[model samples]
Target: MSTVPETGTLALPPLDGLGQLLPRLSRRWPDRTALVTDERTLSFADLDRESSRVARALQDRSIHPGDRVALFSQNRWEWIVSYHAVLKAGAVVNPLNVMLTGEEVAYILADAGTKVLLASGERLDAVGDELRAVPSLEQVVSFDDCGHQVEQFSDLLAVDDDPGFTPFPVDPGSLACIAYTSGTTGRPKGAMQSQRSLVLNCAYAATMHGRTSDDVVITALPAPHVYGNVVINATFMVGGKVVLRKRFDAEDTLQCIVEHRATLLEGVPAMYAMLLASPALEDADLSSLTRSTVGGQTIAETVIDAWESRSGVPLIELWGMTELSGLGTTHAIHAPNVRGSIGVALPGVQVKVADTQDVTVECAPGEPGELLVRGPIVTMGYFNNTEATAETITPDGWLRTGDIATHDGQGHFFVVDRLKDMIITGGYNVYPAEIERVLIGHESVALVAVGREPDPVKGEVAHAYVVLAPGQQPDADALIAHCRQHMAAYKVPRAVHFVDTLPTTSSGKLIRRHLRSSATANA
Candidate 1:
């Protein structure tokens, strides 16, 4: 192990606000389409005006700067406006996952101490009676008429001018947003993101992806996750027209690309798989799709090849986390990626693998170790969780990404697996991603996930859960044999279970914890 010099923080300009991106574009391309949904299309100027009105309305409700504002809505123009408006008011925007139930939503609201909530009717329905118990929640605004003291969204936009409203004192260091992790490991930790981090990330992404103003972007991922948060801001900053969808439908997503002549597609592995499986793909004209980005999960090798071949677009695998304000590394637009590598770190972002005990000591090239990243995109800390913050960020100022990874001399990175997800069998460490990456290449396997199975002698053993391709006969022994052929006997899974589908988060990240719990329950 060797110690690599930590990339020190830069002296950046005061970002002041997260909502500043759209306004700049509104001035430059006021007439260009900024947001598109099934219900409506909004130009840059329109988005600016509406978001400002929302800010003024929020101000009218006595919501002040530094307060917490929750946005619980499906992907819509209103949701986008509400996000910017909350930031413009200098309040922290807490974007809630649409799939979360009422109880889950209430827990976050109470924890975040959100004073105001802007929810769509559908989202409100998901968290109906549970919200009434939140004493800290003072106001609730709905997109449509939902009773129980919910104010209408249209009413907030009735007055456009803000003569009496005064902009709050905000700085680059202001806590702009709190993006909560999915809590697959434990209770969700709110990652505190600064205004400067958000702005800088947009520029970083634009450079990494070589995005231009002419690109038409399809935001297929949910608006709440970290991936969506950064993608939306970066796409807008690049002056790309965003097509927002409430939920992903493979056919609809492909059609939208053709209809809007979308140049970029953003989604997780599952979404890409569905898009590749879309019957319309065979005949559709997807020449407009120049780039497709995938992350937040392990992508199947076959799925990657299928999408790229069918659409004639390259699938750029990316690596990021909520703590990084979104991304840390990506494949350069014109550069070829190493087979197992995610790509080089973005400009101003430094990534290095380090020994588990000492973050200062770097791992040898091609050796798997914890990845430590230092960049403007890294978060301030976990909100209200000082212990976790201390545990995650090294004293030398590197955010200890819990994912295990390796990089070659050329700077290409390969995310092996989550540190927490590492399985110890017979005193040897096994990474599920390595096994899954190998298994996914098999002809019969469509999707495969590896989990830790309890074993009496070895302490724990690997178990494979696979979903076979359509019409293929279930053959667990064949897969086990395949693993044995490619990997050492100890690293191969002891048993295999065939399933209809594997569990995943909205972003398509395989939730191994869920499978582990199920394995325990079954055992």
Candidate 2:
């Protein structure tokens, strides 16, 4: 399941903060376009100025050092600027998932005690009411025109160039961001990450990915997430131009790569599959793309073959998590995907496969067990959830990654089944426990179990099984529609099944495997 070690790990030298690498890039690469969008572009120098302006805006709102600033917006140049500004101001940036419902967002804002929020238009409306109710939230700014009780992003920039902001001293372990990750647990726990941790990952990516100032990157992931943060920030650190997209559309992403002469394309397996499915891919001039970093779950062999055959670029697969600042094991440069291998641990990261009975014992090669990751890139811990954090990270500094993987003695790794019941559908992480909890709220359901069903397109989707109450009879469409009102769209179960009784252990714990087997039989 593992492959030979990669050509480079984190051979790249370190910097203080992730954004600290920017000023130097701007100074050296002055007029080069630092970021590109469909409608606007920002040069290296412009990015510095914009970041300064954003920092000043936060200061004007009385944001203090170490305060949390929630960035509840989609991808845009401003999003990048806000990231730099928040860091410069010595405040932690909480990148809110754009997919979460308003209530879910409000919960995070309240938990993080966010003072200032930068949101996109639709995002503003989605969370406006909840945001207004959060007393800790002092100000709100929108990147686009929205008739909300908030300041316009453009108006904030009209100040007489005197942003009056200064960079604050930062420690390697100082809290830099609180990225909320919904794992197998029903609730989203904020993973506390530091500036040093993120910058280390970015620097490592910049070195290992072979990026240069002339390189142009096309991103196919959500920017608020850690993966997108690493790709976008790493590209910036390498003084490359970023072609930012609000959403990942196969045709649009491919067209942008060709038009911009992008040198790198980064995405998850679902994204690669979608790109391969694109009609434009057959004729699109993709010579500009040198390689593609396949993030998230390892891709299927046929999909990888199709992508290599179609794009003529190597789909370099890597394994990582939000806790690890977005990178872990990646293949050696130009190394082929050998039998679904995720490759060895990246530079600066120490990985081991431990036995289930005794974590102290390392698993032999090709033997599936719990995967443990250790590195500076790992999160400090979960915010305000010390118990969960304590459970995840051993006192000795190793993080129980909660993933089932195997590693060969030569420093290679391969994924087995997931140790956690988190389903990845269309590149989105969907925790079955979260969906199951929500479904249990339905009055018609006496009991419920949620599991993943194999999907040809999305990879896998949530499939919920329900046993109705004695007299109540609920329809599938209605139950699904109800879930839409409670959770994000991507989290809604793709299909619903009604059963007389669900299989369970003698101790009364619902057996998900039995349900999965039944689903397979029915399919």
Candidate 3:
């Protein structure tokens, strides 16, 4: 049995499911502002009533416990309502990235066996009839009045109040959400997050950060992202107000902070960089910000210092993955903020750096190795992929995070690199295998390999090294445009290098680590 670490002084009320959050908060602070969007603001009471009505609508459509319901849309009040409503209706919520192309969405919906889809009108339009091909998808609900064959989300909120309606009972250990994350297998894997895992993560993360009802947080991270989910749900758990934006924009983020007098700002490292570059940031009133958080990818200390010097607030660095439901490690609000470290594991969680060759052997304090975690925050397993799950999680319950890190003598963890070839750009994960898979689809590309290139604004961008077919002329723009159709814009390579050959080992495996140096020499 794994030993559970002490949680210290944080106290949280027990809840069976995420559906209970709104009802409990409404009773505590019904009239308090629960959510604020560019379109409108909603109180806790309003949010509860609206979500309940949607849950009723979902039930009306025959959604039930364990049924998969996908929410494919940008950040909006309806998306938030739909998330809670799915849980209330006793269905599993699968929030999808808005940046995903229609084909990608179709694959996820089909893979998750989604029974219903709640999406924005624009998203519905973008996907067109692609989602209809998903045999498991029984219904489509549009957030706006789009001419798609779908139900109107507005109609769901128009129903009569069912005061006696109660959310369905669910075991805390049952799956609550299926978050898809790109993996090295050239496909996205669904990380099965249990109700216990997600709820406890929110409680622990919120407590560690000293989140309270008095806080007003401003975030522009997409609603589908695991980090974004934590930011939204954690705030809701404490009855704090969340200022949701459709997307991240430097100027708009600054404006929201000044306008709302936001007590906390949450975003990835790239977002902070953008804010620092924003002309409005110099004159922006950020006095209301008591502290801020930066995560998703490693950030430069200079950028952290710049933000703190200008805003006069602590920039807490955190590390997490979809497999963990949200945060795995972070600094407590009262703890010492180690400049480069990702901080210690959340209370009740155990983290260690293991030898790459032998995971059973722990690495020395200053030695770098694979980071492994064991806790309730870890995902039960990858959805419907037992092979992948077995490869990731040890028999002893340690989940291999695929991240290279080292532990200081004081318990702080510092990430050194990624053992996996996955690249993170602008807080979004981009797998090299996925990009290579897309590139290989091009007829002009005889052989292809993808590698990460250092970028200034975005942490890293994909760079493709290709060996063209006979009689094929290399046109970088053409290949890039082809990628745009098959993949999301962010996944497209920043540059394409045409080379005669790529470095490969005797075993015929393309050596990605040596791609940059080889490509430079060959180019």
Which candidate number maximizes TM-score?
1
Question: What is the TM-score ranking, best to worst?
Answer: 1, 3, 2
lDDT of 3 by residue, 1-523 (tens): 9852222232347998889889888876788898999898999999899999999988888888999999988899999999999999889999887767888889999999999988999988899679878889888889999787678988888888999988888999999999998534567899999999889888877888989888899988777888888999898888788999888788999999999999999987557755775678878999999999988766667667878999999999999989999999999999899998999999999999999889999999889789999988899998888999999999999999988888987889988656777789999878775676567657676667788888999989999998785567999999999999988998899999998877653112356777888887986
Clashes of 2: 3
lDDT of each: 0.81, 0.78, 0.85
Query: Where is the poorest 10-residue window by lDDT in model 3?
Result: 3-12
Candidate 1 vs candidate 3: which has greater TM-score?
A: 1
Evaluated with lDDT, which candidate comes out highest?
3
TM-score for each prediction? 0.92, 0.79, 0.80
Off by over 4 Å in 3: 1-12, 422-523
**Of 2 and 3, the candidate ranking higher by lDDT:** 3
Kindly give the stretch of ten consecutive residues in candidate 1 with the minimal lDDT sum: 4-13
lDDT of 2 at 193: 90
lDDT of 1 by residue, 1-523 (tens): 9852222221224346667665666666788887899899999889888888998888888988889999887788898999988988888899888778788888888888999889998778777799998989998989978765789999989867754444455788779888888777678888999988888877777778877777789987777787887788777776777899888888888788889999899998778765654566777789888988988866766678877888777889898888988778889888886554678898888899999887888999988889999977789998989999999987878999988988887788888889999999989999888788778778787777899878999998888887776668888889988888888888898888887777777767788867755445444
What value does the lDDT take at residue 315 in candidate 2?
79
lDDT of 1: 0.81
Write the residue-wise lDDT of candidate 2 on 189-270 in tens digits. Answer: 9999988888888777776677767678998577778788888888887677888888878889888987889888988755
